[model samples]
Target: MAPGTAERIARLIAPLRVKPGSRVDLARDFDPRYKGPLKKKDSAELLAVGVTLLAEYQQRLAAQDTYGVLLCLQALDAGGKDGTIRHVMSGVNPQGVKVSSFKVPSAEELGHDYLWRYAARLPARGDIAIFNRSHYEEVLVVRVHAEVLDRQRLPGDVRTADIWERRYREINAWERYLTDNGFRVVKVFLNLSKEEQRTRFMKRIDLPERNWKFSAADVRERRHWDEYQIAFSEMLSATSTKWAPWYVVPADRKWFARICTAAVLAHTLTGIDPQYPTVSDKARKDLLTARRELEAEAPKGAAADPYAARHRSAGG
Candidate 1:
């Protein structure tokens, strides 16, 4: 029922989820390359099933118009976040889904609280919003680089040494509030290995079409890989609450990662179990009246049902 192939796949990847209040040591706790029994060959089929299920659930979610889903994807450069989003969500109606990629904050964004921009882009009722890089960036990148924090322009008194801890508490509380108010939060951390990251960087440079995706800034950021890892571990440990636990997807293999991410989403939507709105007695009566009027408008002695002749002609 999850981002996995079937119930079996979902159970297989359950260990990837970070439990509440559990300490995360990315290097020690999770394997960036672990795929369990799943192979690359099965990814397409598994992903296809997941996508179809997602489309059905998405339609129900929209028709019900009762809840919104927010999928927060946090990853380092070359972590396959973009690819995962593209492939996993390919089947959903474009209008029912939104993909927001958060980059370096603009002057206007910096002027407001770090979460201000994110809060504005939250999913509306009955839709899904995917945050490529989310509010967690404040804890990940900002904590990694002290200068980034200074740029936030917080009051001096608010910039205590325990700012990260305080922010973690604030974020947890904010997410809790969102859950209480009908938005379900699904957080995923794409755990890409450093070696694989280097390989991807080389491929981006080696392929002419992908050269534009490569950036000097990406290389600079790679230098702080260890720092980012530490930041990610801490963030996962502190913020993986019962309401919105983190799914640490093994991201070294793009296909596997996509499958896991899709399964996670499918699983969440399953838990939500959104249903189509039931027609009330009054509405049903009105529908019957409308059907009669439409039938009466047909030509005299002609079939009131447009498809009736077609079905007879086709020997249906």
Candidate 2:
């Protein structure tokens, strides 16, 4: 990798990372429309480079078959999570990538433990799995709307005052366990501003093609913006651990957000340092023998007049 490329990637990611144990105040700590030091054109160019590098790294990761990457994206409605995934991850080979979008859980999912539905979607070794919205919803949306918990039918004690804190701890421990077991978790929160969200909502409402995306419930949820903000801030402060820190990317500028996401992923995959597996001496020897046999079977004089006999037989 070029040093300049590495530096660009570092700059793109540095401002966004919420270090472990660091308190996050959302309003004070992050900007929803930040574009860093790069101009729009420069940011676009850098993102192209970063996306190419990410594709290369993903290929090596798949070939090594020794590590798994889990990318978790969390955001409010119309926050561009889908756009980030589409544009940033477009270069990667689909066979090596799996994307699971978590929505309202089915009755069967609600019957299991909160984490059970997510556990089954984890990436296998040599693969990258992306979660459009992930397990964090348990703490974010569920925390903001306590009534959702009533559906869980948990014992009163289990859903007591300390439940949020307990869930945060469990999430941190779960992420630590995943890191210890060869999975690298990259979590991103697309920090979209309320004003930007309203603009997007209007576009969804007025545009014929996007009408299907507009929902009355989205407007209903926007009424709780402050509550969601508080929930998100608390979640970030509590769960951004050493093994799996969160990058709160500014989402108002869709292009810049996409670039930030691509840069973070490129940087993370580079740190993993995946490579093609080395061949053992015995395997190398077998390859050599196979090569020799293939070479030995080459037709004599083919190089000088490869298709001469065929042409003559056809009376050309």
Candidate 3:
């Protein structure tokens, strides 16, 4: 049976409250109506809306100075998190955008609370903060590698089961607090099939430079794929809420993944406009005069670079 467009859109907005230590199916509820190989035209069409929404969101961030957008992106290695961020957010102004790739926490970071670095990196008023992998890792990685807790030195009171649930409750409450304090959260779990991941892993092995990216951990993690999926599904169901929704993006096709992600981001951000700052009437008059003065000095008859040459230089 065919799912209607309305039903598909509803899925996009639906909140997921995935539980801690459990997997969730945040994969796309893709419909044929919106599924197609992403060609240049399709990408451009998606970008048009993305650019506009980003501009609007930028304005709101600047004006409200209180509201922010916290976009959390998580996926297996090579799930295209970096690429998606690059392509989908290509049009966003660099000044208003901030990307944080949370790798292994530093020795100093280990000294403070788990969220210390995270709290420091939270988007300022009128900013968009992107977390490549977020505090969720404290749950995922810590659970997968129990030794990681040795570094955290958590209070003795936090038993394994109690700690996991506490962290889940803490995250939910934290997100709710942020939303109430003027922030919109978007969590995306890139859904890459095991077969697709195997293909990517093979590519890394076959290519010379890519060999460096392959690790024992990759092989190790594959062993736990089922557990991770179960964990992810539970996480989505427990954490997915109306205030901050989760988008399950199918990632078999990298290009399509970028398009769909950009679409969702644009959809969410369009409600708030991020406009270029306005100048006063007097400032505008002065700026216009300065522009006219500069234009007057333009050399009229000079030979310009050939279109082909310009195009070549610009394109490549």
Candidate 4:
């Protein structure tokens, strides 16, 4: 990557990152509709470039088979998490990428620890895994609806005071462990404004094609918008560690959000600096020998002349 390009992308991403140990008030610290310093057209162009770069980087990462990348996306309804995944990751090789969309846990999933369902979905070395929603839901949604926790059947002491804080600490430690094991966790929160969410919901109702996306339950959850916001703010503040920080991306502008996501992904992969593995000296020698053998077997001049050979063989 060119220095200028790297610097430009870094600038675009810097403000969005929730610094570790800093409190973040979503309303005060981020604008859900922000498009940064670029015009729409410029941003789109940069995003295209970023997509290409991401694909290249992913190829290198896969070929190296040394590190894994995990992208966890969190957002409220109509927040564009699906769109971001579709567009931003469109350029990557499917074989090298795995996407997991977490919905309501099944009986089997609930039987295990909250993170158990997610652990199996994590990327292996040289692959990228995306979580449409993740373990954070244990804190965000489960916190918003405390009753949901009652079913977990945890020890009485584990459910007592400071449980949320304890979860945050656990998450931080878990992410640090992943980093130590060569997995880079990129956490993205698509910050959508309530007004924009309302507009999107209205669109879902008005457009027949999008009608299926509209759910009465989503509207019910909208009533807890303030609670969700507080939950998100606290979550961001607590878990945005240096090893696995959170990027609070603006989602009102889908194009800009996609661009920002691609940029952040590109930056993270570049930071990992994956490279194609070097061939061993013996392998190199064997490759050269194989090349020479294939070269020696190349078709002779008359065999290569297909038209002439056909005529000669036919006695023409």
Estimate the TM-score of every prediction.
Answer: 0.94, 0.92, 0.75, 0.94
Question: For residues 41-100, what per-residue lDDT tens digits would candidate 4 score against the true structure?
Answer: 686677779889999999999999999999999999999998899989888999999999
Tens-digit lDDT track of model 3 for 1-316: 1235334433443432233444444443322123444475566665565555566566666666656888899888778898888887776777878999998889999999888888888887688889998878877777767788888888777756677677777888888989898787878777788888899999999999989989978888899887776666666666767676677777777766676676566555654434456689999999989877765665786324345556887899
Q: Report each candidate's C-alpha RMSD, comma-separated, in the order given.
A: 2.4, 5.3, 7.2, 5.5
* Residue 133's lDDT in candidate 1: 95
| Total backbone collisions for each predicted model | 6, 0, 34, 0
Residue-by-residue lDDT tens digits, candidate 1, 11-91: 966988999999999999999999988988888998898899999999999999999999999999999998899999999
Off by over 4 Å in 4: 301-316
Q: Is candidate 2 or candidate 4 better by TM-score?
A: 4
Better TM-score candidate (2, 3): 2
Preferred candidate (lDDT higher): 1 or 4? 1
Q: In model 3, how large is the Cα lDDT of residue 84?
A: 88
Indicate the worst ten consecutive residues by lDDT in candidate 1: 1-10
Let me know the TM-score candidate 3 reaches against the reference structure. Answer: 0.75
Tell me which of candidates 1 and 3 scores higher on TM-score: 1
